[model samples]
Target chain A: MENIIELKNLRKVYRIGEEKVIALDDVSLSIKKGEFCCLLGTSGSGKSTMLNLMAGLEKPTKGTIRIKGQAIEKMSEKKLAKFRQEHLGFVFQSYNLLPMLTALENVSMPLTFKGLSKSVRDKKARDMLKAVGLETHIKHKPSQMSGGQQQRVGIARAFVAMPEIVFADEPTGNLDSRTTKEVMGLITEMARENNQTLVIVTHDLEIAGYADRIVHILDGNIEKIDIINARRVSNEEADNIISGADAVPAGV
Target chain B: MNKRDIIRLAFKNFMRRKTRSILTILGVLIGTSAIVVMLSLGIGMNESFRRQLSSMGSLNVIDVNPWYFIEDGRGGGYSGQNVLDDKAVAKIAAIEGVEAVTPFLQTGLRLVSGKYVMYANIMGVDPNALEAFGYKTAKGRMLTEDDTTALLFGSNTPYDFYNPRARNNYGGGYVYFGGYMGDGVERPEPDVDVLNDKLVLTFDFSYGERRPGGTGGSEGGNKKPKLYKVKGVGILEESQDERAYSIFMNIEYLKKIMKENERAQGSMGPRPGGSQQEGYSQVKVKVTDMNNVQKVQDQIKEMGYGAYSLTDVLKSMQETSATMQAVLGGIGAISLFVAAIGITNTMVMSIYERTREIGVMKVLGCMLGDIRNLFLIEAAIIGFFGGLLGLGFSYGASALLNRFAGGLFGGGYYYGPSQDSIVSLIPAWLALLALGFATLVGIISGFMPARRAMKLSALEAIKTE
Candidate 1:
């Protein structure tokens, strides 16, 4: 598969007063087209930082980031915003939908940035909401919707623009186990149907089971890269596969 | 986003905080109306002054007096040869902007008709120049060059004839008290209709009165001055002009009479070999336009003559009004300034409240310039609507002032008794300018807040609550 995203020697550091905190160090990774990849990590494991860096939300201290064969690391802020609108989508952990906007409006926002007319963007957003099973909640504001429902709207927004890559950062962090499975299934299913790349960052093993590959990150470093042959593995199978990969030497 | 969409978003955002936006617009309304009404009062004052002055005389007429001291420009001063003569009249007529010039030959005379006699200050003028001098008659017509003996009566001159013998009688010599009298007393016309009666003029003031030492006849030593039979050609329309009290005549006829009087008195007209310089003591010059009166008067003065025009008075009056306008407009601007501050405050508060929304829009690929334009358009909308409404209010205020504010000045000289006086005026151009100015104020007030919105970082703004 062709690689849609490539990162080499990526480093991120935070300066807190007199100390330098390294959030990410010497991270070399590539995400393939139509690949469902997961960065499984606990708190303070630099998974969120890696996601932000890869999305061009934050500049890295040292690295080169190539998305769809275009170097985006040194791009201007304006150019980066256009690049994000054209090729990238993000589903935040908090499901940051505007409280004043309805589900349809929230979903249509990304298409608005693409300068689509109101009628066209509204129709596209309506179709995306229906696909996410929130067609009946199109006019419902985020404050009026449940946490799981709002997450669905967020997922609808991320895919409505048909971006080349969609990044999900703990998209179901506030949802129950049942809702999490539904949102995760919906996101993976949509990405697979469109052959779009998906990157999920999460601390949950059950969430990692949906990915074709899982990269376990610890202490600002990639501890193991586990390739599962069968997609949508059971939680128990995902744990064994990741534990077996961790047993090998660091370079293997 | 397209411009139309941006404007729509701006309007929506402005309406989001309806109460605040309305209050801000109200402030602008008050400010705009205040300035407009205040400036209108100043304009009204000047208009009234112009009306009053024009009633007194032609504002464009310049009176040129002969200067005795003529500066030869070669150290010779006071030559006394720069009199307002025929040569000077021709020169003045040739000057740019001078429409017409006529020399005045004035003398006191008495008119006798029937038993009534009227003493009149007769002004002799070029027969052809009377119409250009703006003389309008209530009857007959102005003097023409073809008439050898002609007389034009002043509006009030016809009413001034009185019978000296009726002075001691109960119902006696009458003066028209402004064409009004007590109840049932009809306004009396002139006892002697000069236009129809056989009239004779003489330089003698006691022409029709009995002499003290002789019988009432043309006797020796008390002989009546040479009586010239003249016809009253016209009666002037009653006006505020001083000409309403002066009689007009052909200058050549008047000069011939003066010579006849001199001959009848058996006096030599001039010393032999002493040059008899013929000139007029005063000359009247009419300007083509009122605005050009000052320039024409200056040119006349440079020709070694003293010139005065009513435009000087108009200019001084205009200066006073301009000062008044500035002070009034300043007071109005202060309120507008306050309104501007209110707009800025409202925009800043709106920015603070919408910080998260701005960040989201920015992250969604809204241009920085678009965000700035949104706020500016919002502010401008407030100004535009306010200005439009303010102009409407100004018209209402103006109408009210004209209707009920009459005699507010206590009928002072500046506020004359003219029936159509305007107390407050707002010309169309002034209304338009006020609207544009108010809009500009709104744009200026919105500038700083818009810049702050544009400079806000997307990351930080999203992090804000």
Candidate 2:
């Protein structure tokens, strides 16, 4: 209903040995509050780049990108770090859980960055993992867990802090079709329960089936945008919903 | 993240590579022990010098001797008057920093018992000043003002007595001057028990001289030469001091004996002045503090006496020991420098390996300063533990050195055979300072590596394998 993330004329250019390559063409986009959106593109079409830019992980060459009406691109590194900690979470394509940490530790990492006490962050992370059906695997390290389980931990980490936005890039790119549907369902369900904005970047058409809107990007430019009501379109999808996700409280 | 969490994460990362961490810590250990032991040697030398010099004579005591008819060795090119007599002793006593002043008077006398006679220095001194002069008896009480008839024998004073007839027959190689026979012959034991024997002192220098084969009698031997009955009140411990091979008595009593003996002879004395008019042989000034010894000596010298103290020798000895310590410390510093380089190298290698981990931490909103603090704390912990262990090693080394390292330098590093000789000393301050310095070295060594970690671009670091 309300615009939580706004991008006006976003452009990103990279210099490769004497050639100027445009990684992201002039693109104007806005993500709404509580919307589960998908940025769909081929390998070189800048979907991951878009995710990175929105998460404040990379500086854009030209654009005014604002989150909650504050210009993120213009902020200094120190301020951006604090801003990201308080407002954003990230899930990478490879799951990117620190291999040395257990699943519970990985899930609690976002709350840890927010400087919560260990016990407090741990409790929230445990509840988030239970919501994703990984309660029994809390102490399992990333190397010991399956792809689906690690993505569940990743999803738990991204939402445990109850941030205003979550940027997930190819979150299911390394999982199988069965695991892909399960992870995507867990991620969108958790986001929908909290009414938090979720932005996912992927090349798979099936992954877009769970999104409220699908944005198609071709050659660093948005080709089209499709709005869908997946909840209303499929009653069977509701059965596959994460068991305890809808009970997630919307905390201030 | 909180400070504690950042530090905990850094420590966990350090523990990831156990062997590398241990090796780095070992380097710091060797470096710390090296410096501590090297510095302790200089401190040991200084302490040893103090003990040795003090045993010979109190370092704070100055000797002021009269430059009499014999010119002082100072070679002033123009002779000055010897003013360090009884009057000058009072002047010196009034000088600032002089704790006490005592005059020393020595005259030759013959000690006799039955058939044994010995020529000994009859040292006369004020009984009150004996304690200040550090003179203590090993067997009996020291001479006092009322003990005018008493005498204190030096430990070796009995050795000066011998039969001149037996010595002339012996072939005079070892000088059997202690009433002894030649080789393979039983020497004559002291015929007098000094404490209980009838001790007599005669001021006549030739009292023991006898004609070679003439019935063992000198010119005045038949008359007994007015024997003065004295009591042996004390026997002093043997020392490398002016009192060695001498006998002590009250100064006024010795002067009275000499004056009365000359009156009985009624002959012309050797010098212009009578024995009663003779001045003190030397003056001793005790100082309150060792640091003030040189000052007191200088003032005494300006007053025109040949003055000296142990500080003159101590100053040169300390200088030599300081140079020796510097060279040794330099050698130790080179080792520590190598260790510092090892720390930097280890940190650099750690950074290269943990690039992705650091990137993950940064992306998770850990502050750049926190990342820097983490690495520094890790390096410093290594230094702290190494320093603590190194100090333990140095203490062990010091104990072993003092116990078994004695007698290496002509009996001992001490002046005499002393049990408290120290070859290496690590004072408390040195140990504490070494610990702090080692930690500082670790922090400084980690500085550049930490900066590199802080400057790493999060985006590129995460993209690294």
Candidate 3:
């Protein structure tokens, strides 16, 4: 497997008026193509910061970050925007689908940036919503949908543009346990079906159980890299686990 | 993103707050109508001037005369120096704004029928340039170049003829002629029909004779007159002008008759006197514009000839009208300025509300230029619709003026040959300019808000609500 994302000595410092706090301290990591990776840490442990850095959402204070051989740390704002539009997709924790837009319109947003005809983008969006099993909720706005359903729309939007990497920043943070399990299953299943790279940031052990590799962080530094070698859970098995059949069966 | 997407997104954004958009558009509407109506008043006044001048003569026609003296204080009474001859006529015709020039070779002649004879003022003109001079005949056709021996009778020309024996009491021009055929009944009409009359014309050298007290004698005991048998080709309608009392004829024919009379008199005519009646009495230069009339007249004056137009009175009237127009326009401009402020307020509020949307668009790969253009197009749409509706309001306002105030200016269509009724006038070009002006105001008012939208930080904007 080839590494599609590389981080070398990455550092980020935030200044709150005067006091400076280190968010990501010399973070170094690599994720292979088509691999599902998880950054697991508690609050203030910089898991979200690391995800943001890899996703080119913020500037790094020092060192280089590359994705698919393209420089992320040094890219200009305009070029980074193009990079994100062409190669990256994001699902925020709050299910950041525009409240004014319906599920299908939200899903087709990235494709709109791609300049596809309205009918073509709508067709693609319809297919993605159907894939997430939200075909009936396609015309419902984010405000009108349930947490699980809105997250499904977010996942659909993330993969609709066919990006190489999808960043999930605590994507199930607002959903219930049952919805969380279902949302995670849909995200990982979509990634595997498309052979796309997925990077999720979360503090949930159940959510981390779905990843192929879990990298743990503490106090802005990588604590350990845990490679999970276990049978992958299908959407049916994830449902069963939520129904009290068994847990994800973590291997230490 | 592509243009369609950007426009679609912008349109959707504009639709998000419908009331605000409608209010802003209404503000622009008020502004546009203000400017249009104010400017229309100015145009109406100008149209009135044109109509008033049209009744007198062409506003484009400037009359040139020889400047007889410098001033009373110095070098005065140097009269009859510059002859307004063929050379000066050519010179005036060569002027830049001069569309055409015709010399007035006026001769006082007597038209004699069998027993009735009348004295008339005969103005010589180039027959080919009659239509250009706006001369319209009421009876027969106007004199053309081929009508070398033709004459056009004025409405008053036939009425001026009287029996020489009966001419004594008809001095005031309203007395009965032909022995009062009957006092309680109608008087005998002129023996010759003006348009079909074959009248003998006798040139008297005292015609256009500038001599002091030179105009006294006509058909008297010590005179020998040269006669030419002439035919009347046309009759002019009555107008509030001197042309109503004058006869017009081909210039070359008048010149020939003048020269023959001079020869017949053998150095006893006005040509041999200090009066110098050999050249044209006056030249009328047709100008291209009423505004350029003064300039062209000044140019002719610089050539040492005196020039005048009704614009001398009209210029004063227009100067006063201009001040009124400016005041009117200023009032309208103040309203438009208030409307522009309203537009700016709306756009600024829009930016503040749409910060998150702008951030989302920026994150979605929309360019900064695209964002700026989107806001501009939104503002322009407001102006576009406002201008369209404002022009509609202006038309209604103008029609109301024409309906209620038509007699204050003109009787709707009583003025000659012009489309304007004069209460409120909006020329096509003024309407176009008002639309463009409203659009520009919208764009300018949107400038600051659009820049602020462009400067918003995308990361912070997204984090904000």
Candidate 4:
């Protein structure tokens, strides 16, 4: 498979009142098209920093990042916004849906920035919500929904725009074991069904079990690259795991 | 994002904090109404001054006098250097903005009808220029150039007649009996009907009464002073103008009578003893518009003639009112400036609250310009609605002031052609200008806060609670 995202000698340093702290140092990685990839590490191990640098949310100190052969670092803010609108989707760990909007409105937000008609955006959002098992909570606000349900809506928003690359950062970090298993199943199933590149950053080993490959990080350095599962998870297998018909398994 | 979506999002954001937005808009509403009402009072004062002046005389008419008083060290004497003759009349007419120029000739004569007699001050004007001078008749037609012996009576001219032959004649004094009397009773009409009575004018002031040292018939055997049979052509409409108390006649006919009076008396006329009659003492110049009166008057003065118009009085009055308007407008503007500060504070507070929402939007690919536009539109909406409601309130306030404060000004009664007195006036252009100004203030107030929102770092903003 062709690489969809490439990082060469990536280095990120944070300065807090004159103290220089390295968040990511000399890290190189590649994410293949249609592959489910995970960056796994403990706290302060630079997994979240790697995700931020890759998403173009932060500028690297010294590095080059190419996503689908586009050098986003060289792009202006306006062009980068357009590029993100067309090609990328994000799922925040805290479920950063606007508190004022309902589930349907939240899901349709990304499409609104794309300038789609309200009818088209609403229709797509409705379909994505149904796919995420959130059809019953379409009109529920985040304040009214459970943490797990809000995270499900967040997942729906990430995929509703049909972006080529979806990045999830600890998407189920606030949920319980049972809800975490369901959210992880739903995210992997959606990525596989759409044949999209999925990148997730998490410290939980069980969440990393859903990815085809994992890159382990320690102290701002890549420790190893492990091939977890060569074949993509099938729809039936994902459904069984989410319904608890099959036992939760680890990536061996 | 498209314009519609941006507006929708902006509207939604504004409505999110309903109480805060309403309070901010209320501040703007009070500011706008304050400015409009204050300025309107100044306009109303100027309008009332114009009405009062117009009742006294035409604001567009300039009185051009040939004689100007020159103050020498000894005393002051009238200078007759600039002659207000036919050539000067033509020169003044040729100057820009002078609509009509006519020499005013005036002399006192005795009017007789049967046993009733009155000493009348008859003013002769160009027959063709009567209508242009804004003379309107209530009874008969104005004197035309063809009517040689025509006369136009003043509204009070008939009321001036008294029975000089009566035993208690009060020494031939005028009996006032024309207007509304005290205690709201209508006074009796005059005994003489000037428009229909057979009337004669003579140079004899003692036509029917006893003279101071001789009998009343004629002085020193003068042949009854040549009675000129003049027709009563018109009676002027009753007004507060002093011109309503004077009589009018054709200039040529009056000049012929003056020459006749001189010939009959075997002496010189009212002019200084010159072989030829001296030029008119004063000429009236009518300007096309009241605004042009000052310009025409200045040109006339430059020609060494003393020019005076009601616009002179009006200009002084307007200067005082303009100062009043400035002070009033400044007071109003201070309130609006405070309201602008209120808007800025509200927008700044809202930026703080919506930092996370803005970050999420930017991360979702919302344009930086769109974010700034959203904030600006929110502020402008507040200003527009406030201005609209404030204008409505200003009209209400104006009507209330005019209704209740009528007596202090003109008592809601105007004598000038078609206008009524008002104490507060708001024209259409002022309303529109206030709205535009309020909106501009809103935009200016929102600029800094919008820039702050635009430059907020998306990563840190989303990380904030």
Q: Per-residue lDDT of B15-129 in model 4, one digit per residue for the tens?
A: 8999998988888888999999999999998888887888778899999987665556688655656667888889999998878888888878889888888878788789888
Pairs with steric clashes in candidate 3: none
Pick out the ten consecutive residues of candidate 4 chain A with the lowest summed lDDT.
A230-239
**TM-score (chain B only), all candidates:** 0.86, 0.79, 0.81, 0.89
Better of 2 and 4 by TM-score: 4
Error of 3 at A240 (Å): 32
State the C-alpha lDDT per candidate: 0.81, 0.79, 0.78, 0.83
Winner by DockQ: 4
Which of candidates 1 and 4 reaches a greater DockQ?
4
Angstrom error at residue B379, model 4: 1.9
Give the Å error, residue B352, model 3. Answer: 2.5
Could you tell me which 10 consecutive residues in candidate 1 chain B have the lowest summed lDDT?
B268-277
The DockQ values of the predictions, listed in order, are 0.30, 0.38, 0.39, 0.50
Across all candidates, the chain A TM-score values are 0.90, 0.89, 0.90, 0.91
Highest lDDT model number: 4
Candidate 2 residue lDDT tens string, A8-122: 8999998999999898998888777887888999988987778778877788999989899999888888887888878888787777788778899888887777778999988
Q: What is the lDDT of residue A48 in candidate 4?
A: 86
Docking class of 3: acceptable
Which ranges in model 1 have alpha carbons more than 4 Å from their true place? A33-40, A89-162, A166-170, A173-219, A226-252, B67-81, B125-153, B168-187, B192-205, B212-235, B249-278, B288-290, B386-411, B414-423
